[model samples]
Target: MDFLKLPKRTSGNRTYGLTSIADFGTPIGRLTNILDDYSHIIDIAKIGIGSAYITPNIKKKVDLYKEYNIKPYCGGTLFEKCFYQKKIPEYLTYLKTLGIDWLEVSNGTLDIPLKDRLNVIEHAKEEFHVIAEVGSKDCNLEMDITKWKEEMQIFLEAGCEYVITEGRDSGTSGIYQSNGQVKSELIEELVKGMDVKKIIFEAPTSKHQMFFINQVGPNVNLGNVKLDDVLVLEAQRNGLRSETFYLEDADANYVNQTPTH
Candidate 1:
């Protein structure tokens, strides 16, 4: 497939430019179909927020992602549930059973102490690739960026491979305002001393994703993407979409070429 040349982007299985999507309630067959053509742009498949419990052929779905080089993992809500139920050990074992190699740990819905959160990260790292998420899911809650940065560092040191800034599936909580706008000030402060590549900004919408891609360049790692939006997001990343088409300076001949039937 000879296509027009485009800007260089990071490869999968490595790091940076990562695109993680949520598989919330999608059946295994439909999930396979989604990944069949677009898995090349997807880095991870997250069974969003406890939806793993009800997914049909869960193990089969996990294996299918692995078949296509896409890592499969659970959302942080499953971890929060196990923590509140005092079944973390059981949860880990269950993930093992499901063949999940990645895990997301967050206290978005529950109030967890820093020490305990770090401990959770420390332990989960032993058996899985951990992604530590920091921020509250409640739109009414406020957080200082300085504190957010410090906590992210702590989680990183605790064995987390990547840190996710909480931007809930609705794109209205955490790093975003209740109205779904990205808080540029907070983002500016959060990246002051942090490795932007090691951070996965939870950008669930095109606007939010475009903001990060533009502000941080095309290699910014993004998460919580919906299954239907993967290729569209890739288009934005590669400047193939209208929002970012200016980044590409196509040859006039190619741009003006007539179509052949």
Candidate 2:
């Protein structure tokens, strides 16, 4: 494979080209099967939404992900639910009991004030690696571009390990329009003068994945990916898929070349 030149990927405990899968109560056996084959390409596993709260054998599931060197965390919606119920302390205890060391702090479905959100992130950093999410899940709720950048910067400064742009599992909110088309201008503006590595764009579909790969290069972090799409996404990242086969760095010498035979 080394003899074939393709887009290079950041390998071995990758800081970029991260693919985070959303697990919606996947049975342990199936999860194990997936990890057995694809753990190397997966960086994180999110117990999607509030399912982590009631998933059977939740602790074992979390431990299994850790065994494969994957950081497993409950979705931020669970955290927001706890916040709404004034059980933030209890939620942290629950996560610790499950042996999960990563946390997602998001306000997608809630209207948590900036001050409170910052305080939550600052305090959570003492116990867990925090990933803060920006943008609303509600498609009709428009967030100003300036506010998006400001909040992202503020979250990073407040000790967030990474900032996530809210493209829900549906791939039709936050940075994307209602029709699932990416707001390209907004994305370009948001990344200007910012460390792209610190931001994980939620790309849950082929179109979104291809766009991010082409626009942000192969090493961009992607989130909210379905369990089955991990291998294909990795292929696209390395220019092995038709959508990204023409990536500029993908051994262009093979293109438009005359055949000696």
Candidate 3:
């Protein structure tokens, strides 16, 4: 059987075209079932905001993600909580015990200074692969595009493997308007001003996912994806969904071909 050629995607432990799932306390059995089917396309599983501390069988869940070669780490908000309590050292120790090697250094809900955050990133880089996040989670908070670009660059220089643009799981903040529409102008400027491959845009909805895939091609790194949306997102990425069916790489001839009996 022949398959139609679709848009090519980065595969097998991708650095780009990453799909990061936000795990909000999925049961180990359910998570294992999901990974068995979709682990090839899933790169990162973020134990959503402070839940890792309270979730049952946390070690087993983390180890399960690792077994499928997915990098599982606690959410940035958890890091902020640790920072607020001045327990960052203890947080690192806790993560080490869980076999987590990726860390998200972010200041979305907290007011940690840029210098302090960079210092943390630099220090954390020695032991973990850091992915720093920029922008606030509050929809009412406004941030300058110039500052966003500058901070992302500095984070990369500070040894962050990727810098996340903080469109929260709701898709209503940071790189998005209060109504969940993307800040297109801001995104355009960001794409032009930096190495897009190093930036992960949090796109939790179908609309958000399609927009990023269309704007940055299928290989754009996206985060905050729900576990259930994984397969649909991959379908959209490869032009298997209506949203991305007209991607540039799609074959025009296939559409125009005459039918045969």
Which structure among the candidates has the greatest lDDT?
3
Error of 2 at 148 (Å): 0.7
Mind giving the per-residue lDDT tens digits that candidate 3 earns over 42-147? Answer: 9999999899999999999999999999999999999999999999999999999999999999999998999989888877899999999999999999999999
Clashing pairs in 3: none
Error of 3 at 65 (Å): 0.2
Off by over 4 Å in 2: 248-261
What TM-score would every model get versus the actual structure?
0.92, 0.94, 0.94
Give lDDT for model 1.
0.84
- lDDT of candidate 3 at residue 3, scale 0 to 100: 77
For residues 1-261, could you state the per-residue lDDT of candidate 1 as single tens digits? 949766556675656778999888888788788888998999988899988877778888889989999899998998999999999989999999988978888999999888887887777788899989999999989999888999999888788899999999999889999999888999987665787777999999899988887677666779999999999998997888777776443222121122111
Which is the winner by TM-score between candidate 1 and candidate 2?
2
lDDT (Cα, 0-100) at 63 in candidate 1: 93
List of clashing residue pairs for candidate 2: none
Question: What TM-score number comes out for model 3?
Answer: 0.94
State the weakest 10-residue window (summed lDDT) of model 3.
252-261
TM-score order of candidates, top first: 3, 2, 1
Residue pairs with clashing backbones, model 1: none
Model 2 lDDT on a 0 to 1 scale? 0.87
Off by over 4 Å in 1: 1-5, 248-261
